[model samples]
Target: MPKARRKPEALDGQHFEVVVVGAGMAGLASALRLAMFGKSVLLLEKHYVVGGLNSFFARGGRKFDVGLHAVTNFPPKGSGKASPLIRLCRQLRIPFEELALSPQSFSRIAFPDVDLKFDNEFGFFISEVERLFPREQDRFQKLLRTMEAFDAYSPEVAGDVSARSILGEHLQEPLLIEILLCPTCYYGSAVENDIDFASFVMLFDAIFRQGLARPLDGIRRFLNPILKRYEELGGKRRMNLGVKHFVTKNDIVERIELDNGEIIFADHVISTCGVVETERMLSSASQDENADDVSRISILESIAVFKKQPADFGWEETIVFYNDADVFRYERPDELTDPRSGVICIPNNYRYPNGEQMAEGQLRVTCLANYEKWVALDENSYRSQKEICRKAMLEVALGYLPNGNSMAKELEERTELLDIFSPRTIKKFTGHLDGALYGSPRKSRNGSTRFGNLYLAGADQGYVGIVGAMLGGVAVANNRILRGD
Candidate 1:
């Protein structure tokens, strides 16, 4: 068993080499990396628990993960140093085997006309594309080569370049393009209707190329190890304490005021809260230019727990990205949610060791949601709308499953519990303005700000997914903080 996390010493009037805000993946990783380098780092979080959007919650004695559908960027064992997961483990000094990851059986992209199934193998996806859209097979290959060469992490790269425009240049079939965009955009894109080409390349590499996997026990299994390792390295952390403001002097953060009104100081501050949220903490007035960049895109998710496993009812795929409409619309709806296109995730489908399985079946349906519409509702209306939208989302999602229409009545009957989370839940918990799922459309690629010592990480740092967020945090710490940039 791991040692208990030691409580941090008093923070008021204390100084550190670096202060990391928000205990999300990025912030945790940043503080851990800095600590490993023998720097005095203070990690602060407003929430009592860590993990931020990737965190978990307990209800009725059962735990549920928040943002994890699957941990993207899963490479097979012995995949070598080039793998991002491998590199991250090496940097953080954690053993790869400690995560106890389980690979997916297979997942599918379901549309009104066609269904494409893919697993960890890139060739399988290629074969599916060839079998489904034979005319664009060669064009798709060319597109893959283009994505392979694109330097998505370069600070000088243009992040706002439209991915749809690039896809148009490479492929002629609009359906195929939309089909590919369905999963990628849902997984990471902040921009409505389309994802930027830079993010497209990164997410394409993460989801399709590197593949997806989950820890045997969900996110806490993954997070606890990192947190344990951070504590072992003598990293200091304070829960339920948040940065209220950044007192700046001539474009450099001189001090930080906590939500409790206590003050602390650091030479450099790294924020994983988000671009707009971070900017708002500044004492200066010039940081308001990027306010409009706050993302409008958010999601509403419905989690249903059933009496039996998903496979027992013939729902075997690990994840299903589905679209009821001919043209997939990846944007916030005028109403609360757009159930026409969404994702269905079955957590019970992973191949755990020794045939171990979850005691109960679980299904999660996610759909694009309008933040403003959901936030404007009163408590009574919000509760009523949740129930109404929960049924609607599940109803549409069930149609895409194999023999799903036939099993709907039985599945509904077998459902033991149901929980729903909206854009309002995201905003209230993660402190993301507008409850944006992927943060601002305009990214701070270099993690730079007008304040010289303040840098951004996580969503607004232009990386997506859990692995990407950790990489973003490590990069900023290495490039800017460690290298003295």
Candidate 2:
């Protein structure tokens, strides 16, 4: 998977059929697609490694996946179907089996009154809901029918519809609505309280129909192959480089200026950076005066490595969506955490290759946090604040355990290491302005820009999560670049 780096001098007058900014999933997918279509592509990144927010990092000889807990849109093997993941693999001519995905046993969405453990299968999820709320069976069935009808996220269907409104139309119980929206919305939502219907449907199809799964060898195993395929397809990638500005002429982008002042011309430019960053990169001549500024939310994530799995302490769920009440509000809170809602992920629960289990377990706890607050603190104060928040979150997390009173004792006794990542850390590493998890809360764009030759993918295109982001990249490439629609 080694790639040749371009010397600064060699990049002066370099030209490519396509210039893609960012080496995240979306960018990688776009570059790969362009390469497969026999176009010369140059993929650029500001980071030393790929994967963007959905990648991994290593510390103390143990590797931990940064953003990906598990992927929702996993199409079963040999289904002979055309899913987003499947289509990309076939288009790239990479075998689907190379991903090595395994369906999770189950995950829990815990409420004060009820605890629902959902398997990957939709029938199982529906049946569990029906069993608990017997009278809501018909309602649940109607929801399934509606979701099936709206599965294909057409522009007309996805037009600015609020997810809260959509759920309200089907169910009356507040608890039921919260239960349905909790996992997917928290995973990736740009809006304050309501996500777009398209995002909702995308999450529904990915979680309910396709089911969730984890790569046997972690996220790297899944992405590395795609990256390797990108390289093999004749796509060129440049690491530790970023776009500084776009040179435009007559409403079309003709060239890109790098951070090092190197200029590269391109037939087309595809950007995976968010909308705000994209707008900033445009010169005054090409900048859109009416460009919308999106509202973004940041997060506080803590990683705790345990000497043993939580299963030993009667905590067997792979993921737990816990809240004090049955209300899930996904917004950037003034405080570090709401304590009412957050997610706990146990990566070690995944079925490893050849039935192998890890020697130790890793747990990740994530909640909404204010980026502005973190940015205001000095380095010393920031570290102190992170520790304070981590302690508070751990206390809240203990309540979700089987034996709440004794759980902390068990966890502390077996705790191997603890690491906390603040919003500032996220911004520093990923180059997101405010450490926004999924970019701004803007309406879905068709991946087109003011300039005819420039386009967008990833968060800027309004697709969130691993599958949605990658598919957004492919959609833009196929429709705009390849099909020329």
Candidate 3:
């Protein structure tokens, strides 16, 4: 049966105070906050569902976070302190939980016979690193200070600073170098890709702090309530309505035109679609200008999700990798240029619903494939190529795990590609420039994407995870609408 169209009980505003386009997490969160402030809000989604990039599915006997493996560094609520995302959730009645790992839950570096576990807070992280390599204690302290300082210093201040730029200038240890590159898989970033200090710090601080939380019942459980509350607050949403153009009146976006030929007029427009797509909707430009903006994106992370039994807790972690010593070479080879990464997880007790089980296990493998690679292909060609890419990824999987062939077959049969939002897909569905995850994260140019009255929230800004996206969502609300506006 087709999913029912869930229209709002009341959508009485002819000209809403806030008009949000793209009902992804960021758009939804922005709409919720705006509605709470007594603004009539209308949120439009191009897709069938609401979660955008922040969503999940049930496979095996467990639920899995589709793209977000785990989100860290979100400040938990309590007496005196809280992170901005947490505060917004509370104010908007969005349910969330702060999860603590076994201190050694992240970046447990293992090379051959030696292993160094990264656990605890900032201080503890330094202590653990120092304990492993006493000689680098003093150097480690400097790294911590750098991270602390970097956190306060936004990308707006940092210019063309790649991860290598900061690491090369300050710390230079082979062990530490490996540690720095451990999670590059998250963004599918290559060291040469100019991941400035600010971006590097965002990823570093998150993994070190909040550990990871497998949303209460995967992302669905976490977001459904928020969506429900959005309706209760009199916010409106529509799905499968691909926004095609933005109609500007009085120098502001007055309404959005959907591919379905429906026109929605509103007082404000919040675009969670992305940088490239947002511009396409508003830009009256030639191909040359569009091409230049395409290269500004730093990375492209393609995610694949499959239906299977969920991996349980205390097992091999959700983001697991069975890397074969023989296949991996520190030096980048032509074959492995688009680095393939691992994520083996089961929806165990800690992350599953009260009765959810990992009957059909779930797994997702993400890699950084070039947008140009896909965009260059014709539609039919691209469709055929996606399967080829999947097969190649499966081979890469075999290279990681022992029963590589069998596991690859199982996943190949069940797994489906999720990162269709490549540059072209972004152009097609979301209408982005390069299908950039987070609008141009170039610290060199737009810095923080501070356009006059225009803002960004989604994977394109801040960090890249559930927590980061939520925080970005709130930032759009706070910086664009809430803060004394």
Candidate 4:
């Protein structure tokens, strides 16, 4: 059962052992872990709902998912195989079944001429890749072996290595390399052309080794349990409260002042807000050299609800990575207006824990976007631009659907609802400056700052995806707050 969220006004002079800012996955995980350890925890969120980037919004009697496409790093429930997320679940005491994870049927990566489908099973994925690129089978194996080195609980301390450099070493085929990099980089690329080796391997292990899965009942089904468990352990959550400033003494955060003018004391403060926002709260006078650069490129997402599923039109795969150009350019163009390459997800194709709801389907189409361009648009111009972009993006998305020609007709005819969320939406909802989907390229520090008790979690910590973000919270709680190591 989900616990009722309390208003921030209820907490005027509260004190806790630990105060966690932000109610995203990382903040939720941190509060849960700390409460499980018998520490009095106060979790705060500026938004009314939880999950932040991964959260959902409701409109016209329909609930639409936001940033969550799938749980990329899915650990099987009883397979006994070692999974990175399993450790976090164990520490958090969250039963795997509570997640209600449903593996993807298959995912398609499409280029100008080449189209490949990756199965959900690891063995099947390896077999399919080998079958498709038999000439480079040996190279594939070597790359897999090399990537395994990054399967640890912590980030690799090795000097930064780019994904491009790593792929070039193993394979000579440009298309194959682009295919491998497309999904991972799109999910969490800090750099324009390549991601750091640690991020590369993390995404590889999640999408390639472990495969993708989604909760049957959407994000609420997954989050409510954690919130329930936290409340059961005497943890408290105050919603609609934004941290205004941190009261520090001797380089340690001693208290937090909310935007509502309420001050609360805590021995330690863990911030799930990204580095820039966190730095702003610490003090306006303090300077972080990388604060401005923390946010990478943002995204533009269009969600279309239909009375019928794409599978009805012969589209079987749950996700399709679509590229129009012969040479894949992973970054948004300097102009930031046109998006030639993007991801298209049909959430209905997923195998739900329960029977399928073949009633209505959703197509979530996303592309890299420029936060600056989006935020600068006037009201009338913004609306006009969104409509134009939506139509263009829809045309491109239609081409990837099964029997795309006819599917486009069916979609236009049966469209129940359509909504476009820009970079500004992300920034407004998550409070991440510039609507950055992934935080700083710089890896998160070990949950510590100049102030010994102040720590960073969430995107600021350099982990992406729901599992990675939550684990970041657990790691920080264990290393900085709980263990004091």
Candidate 5:
């Protein structure tokens, strides 16, 4: 059983072996892994709930996932033991079956002139690419061979190398390049309009090679078991509490100041906060040195719940990455949102076991948005603009669907609830500057900082998705804290 929640006063003078900031996937995994080895760990989260970017909320008696479209890096059962998902489960000592993962039925990359569909099978995706861009078949295969040989996890290798430049070297078709980049950038890129080659390789393997899946009961179902296992193993976590600052001495984080002004100490500290966010938390005078590295990328997401399944309206795919123009633009929009290119996800499209399905249809659309524009709005205007953008995004997204024009009316009429979140909402909840979804453009591949005992994890640690984040956390704990590398 877990210990009772410790109040701020009770933990004021407490000392721990390791202090993990942010109870997201990385923090939870790190704390749990350390505790399993009989190390004292303290996990802190500012929000009332866990899961960080992949968290959920209850609205109108219905649960809504915030950042998760689908859990990437999903390999089949008894296969991919060396895969990130399997490795994460193995490291955390969590049974793979406990995840209750359901593979996506299919997902597509839809452009103005072409559509390419793929599922769990890598061969199917390969065939789709060949059929859509037949001339580039050999080039695509050669590119894959190159990616397969690249060591993406090497800490010594520079991660900021341009993936576009590399893609151009392998493939001649601009459309094929754009189509491939569409899903990869939307899924994990922090760099505007392009992704680092290392990240590109990682995401390509995770999304296209390994594929996407989701827990049938939402993120909570996957997180609850991890939290339980951590608690059962004598790990401690405090929710609705956060670290205000890290007091450093001689290149070491010696003390931690809680949000309530309580002071604590830890032999080692692992921060899952984004690079810029974590840098800002340092009490030292040079805290803002890396402020310029803050990411400009943010997103506008809207969710609509309706009475009928999306398949009823001929929308059978689990997710659709769409672009209206030939050249897919992924940069931060000057306006509140750029709905021309976005992602549309139907959660009900997943193939659940025993023919199970969601009680209602849920459609989520995500678009690139300007954080500054959204944050500058007044309260009333913010609310009003959300509604405005919600309608606009849905209108643009509908065009990509089959029989889109006819289904729009029925969708609006059947929609029982509608909610939209802007970059402002993201900052308020996740504390990420400018609501950057994937964190800083510069990644810390080794999870190191200037301080000897301090380290970084999660997004800024050069990992993406839930499983990747957990694996990153485990790596930090095993390599830095426990192994003392």
Candidate 6:
């Protein structure tokens, strides 16, 4: 399909200065920022809700975050000087209560015998790390400092330093390496080759500062406000709306064609979809070479928002499990059983006594899954895919519970498939390049994407994380708006 060229002509329709596609956090953040700056922005989300990954679903009166479980970003100095997320929260006047994670530890790393607890304060966190890896204490501290430096490293301070450069090679603790890389690997990157040090730092910051806290109602509270805020600012959203492809002329994108055969024009199209899909949608020429090559990147899945009753309601806050560095994600799978280990993230157990909301109890389990297989099936086969996923989750849940099977059977009968979050899902729903949850790996030290006006953001450009994604939005928008693209 040929792209319709911008005529340098009169305004059509409402004349939006920017058209944001995909209502995920990145897109929502970008659009909100632009709107606050007084730009006439029109935001489009395929889903009914405004927040993409941040949205929630309700079943059995319990609402769980479909994508976002927790949040990071410290509250900042004072009222009006909070961090970006805080700023958005305040600007929207969304009243939120801050709750610290249970056990006063952010994450408990349990290896075969070593039980290391991580905290919100960086200094405390490092001290704990140093205690666990005493032999390499000096090197471990240096690694922590280096990662923190990467978090605060301004583009101006970068001063030609290569992004691919390692922080330091002196720390050789195999267990430390596993701990450091396991979280990064969840971003779908190769432990050795996929990420830059900046990404690692950003992720660490997120966990440390934003000790996992769910909203009062659940994950929906966070997103519902953001969606309301987006709409309040006059953002446009269409549920069940799907974009088939985009049209570009020369170096500029002119219009996006929806699956319903309608064309929506934009001065600029900021898609949350990834690079591979962007190339396919915006490529003016007619060749379809290497399309599926981009299609086949592996996906991470879990029984996201797995609902169940815990043995003890207080166990909700304390993640009572035996997950070392290798317990969760350790394999390439076409289903959940591939890795053989699964993670149970019990949010309600951390804090709070059971009141009226406590029906039986709230136990949330997420297993690393192979989401690609779900994409291969037709609608009829989806029911069977759900069964495979349910069984896989049950096997992993049985690791801790003596009565896990009966509980698992109860869940299998009631749980919903929710959504299939694959590369293609990210492509269609979020519009990220390569179905990248985070953006592509830096790939080179020079930091070039080999194209003009085409840039990366969210988890693509630098790192992949809550903070990384936010900073990615800032970086790409800087190139386009701040730098006069």
Best by lDDT: 5
Local error of candidate 1 at residue 448 (angstroms): 0.8
The per-residue C-alpha lDDT of model 2 at residue 314 equals 77
Flag regions of model 6 displaced more than 4 Å: 1-9, 12-14, 60-62, 74-106, 151-168, 187-194, 283-331, 334-336, 350-360, 377-382, 398-436, 442-456, 482-485
- Put down candidate 4 lDDT per residue, 1-485, tens digits, no spaces: 11112343455547677889988999999899999988879999998889899888898788877888888878655545377667767878887777878888899888887787886678877887787788989999998888775543464343256878889999978878888888888887766767777777878787877878887668887789999999999899999999989877667776678999987877678998877777777754465545646656788999888887667778778898888875777665565445688899888878885676546878889988888888888999999989888888888877877777667877889999889899898986788877878876655646656677788998767676788889889888888777742
**TM-score for each candidate, following the candidate numbering:** 0.96, 0.92, 0.75, 0.93, 0.96, 0.76
Q: In angstroms, how far off is 45's CA in candidate 1?
A: 0.7
Per-residue CA lDDT of candidate 5, range 315-382, in tens?
A: 99999999998998989998999989999998898899999999999999999999999989999999
Q: Which candidate order results from sorting by TM-score in descending order?
A: 5, 1, 4, 2, 6, 3
Q: How do the candidates rank by lDDT, highest first?
A: 5, 1, 4, 2, 3, 6
Put down candidate 6 lDDT per residue, 1-485, tens digits, no spaces: 22233432355553455666666666766666666555566666677655554566555455545555455554423534335455444443444443221222245555555656655455665777778888988886676666655534345333223223453374776666656555444533422223445545555555654444444355455455556766777665566676676665565565667877877665555665444444555546444644443422344344423344453322322342334344334444555234344345555443433432323344444444444554566876666665566555556654554365656566555554443344445445455444444433332211233333334344334434453454445455545654553
Give per-residue lDDT, candidate 1, residue 388: 94
Query: Model 5 segments beyond 4 Å from truth?
Result: 1-13, 286-288
Score residue 315 of candidate 3 by CA lDDT.
32
Output candidate 4 Cα RMSD. Answer: 4.4
Q: Choose 1 or 2, whichever is better by lDDT.
A: 1
Alpha-carbon local distance difference test for all models: 0.87, 0.77, 0.53, 0.79, 0.88, 0.49
Q: Give per-residue CA lDDT, model 3, range 149-192, as digits (tens).
A: 66522424443456665676666566565555555424423223
What candidate 1 gets wrong by more than 4 Å, as runs, is 1-13, 286-289
Cα-based RMSD of candidate 6: 5.5
> Where does model 4 exceed 4 Å of error?
1-12, 76-78, 155-159, 284-292, 335-337
Which of the predicted structures, 3 or 5, would earn the higher TM-score when compared with the native? 5
Superposition error at 361 for model 6 (Å) = 3.1
Q: Which residue pairs in candidate 4 have backbone atoms (N, alpha carbon, C) closer than 3 angstroms, thus clashing?
A: 251-451
> Over the full model, what C-alpha lDDT does candidate 1 score relative to the true structure?
0.87
